[model samples]
Target: MGFLTDTTHMHIFTWVVGIVLFLVAASMANGTKGKKITHMILRLFYVLIIITGAALFFKHMTIDSMLYGIKFVLGILTIGFMEMVLVRGNKGKNTGLMWILFIIALLATMFIGFKLPMGFNFFA
Candidate 1:
């Protein structure tokens, strides 16, 4: 079942890679040099964060086996939100709230890799 184990890892990896690329490409398409660089760096960090987090998740996670899935969805949502609201128009019109939410989501996402108390699965 080595391939089966690899499937899950590959699934997560591909999804993360795809979303980051989509975000970076979208940012580049918008023609903002600063945003492009920032987005690219953030996207790279997003991949690294997920990769390292995956290792931690395998070692300590319990309760919600779906935490990774939830994080995946949130990653997509966060990228979409950034594209639609922050990067959509002026690219500089106050996005403090969006940035705050993005950072919060990223932090929360990182935390999901660790174990938590019983019967506290957010998805449940």
Candidate 2:
């Protein structure tokens, strides 16, 4: 548990890879095998992101429980919007709203994450 609690590097890496995979999968043709494979890998990253994020959240939760709680919810919403966008796109449905929501949530999550005491203090 010390390794997980020591730093935010693992959590950051998972989300960055997840975002890259999401873009790659989203840009590919929906019905293609490549897209499906990428999507599966992206889903694995999603799980990794949640696990690492939860570990960090629990580790530093005592500092400011309410803020961390908000960050956790925003992180979940960001992931949800990402999945919705990909699924709706694959189904040939409109995904404009989901994309908008995804961007907003992602930006908000990143901002709050940086502001937190544990991570890099770029905001400070």
Best by lDDT: 2
Counted clashes in each candidate structure = 0, 0
- Across 10-82, the per-residue lDDT of candidate 2 in tens digits comes to 8999999999999999899889999999999999999999999999988789854587989999999999999
Report the poorest 10 consecutive residues by lDDT, candidate 1: 112-121
Q: For candidate 1, lDDT tens digit of each residue in 1-124?
A: 3432333455345446645654555445456676567566656655654554454445445565677567656655655555554454445466567666766765665455332332135553
Clashes of 2: 0
lDDT of 2 at 36: 94
After superposition, the stretches of candidate 1 with alpha carbons farther than 4 Å from their true spots are 1-64, 84-91, 114-124
Kindly give the stretch of ten consecutive residues in candidate 2 with the minimal lDDT sum.
58-67
Best candidate according to TM-score: 2
Q: Estimate each model's TM-score.
A: 0.40, 0.96
lDDT of 1 at 106: 52
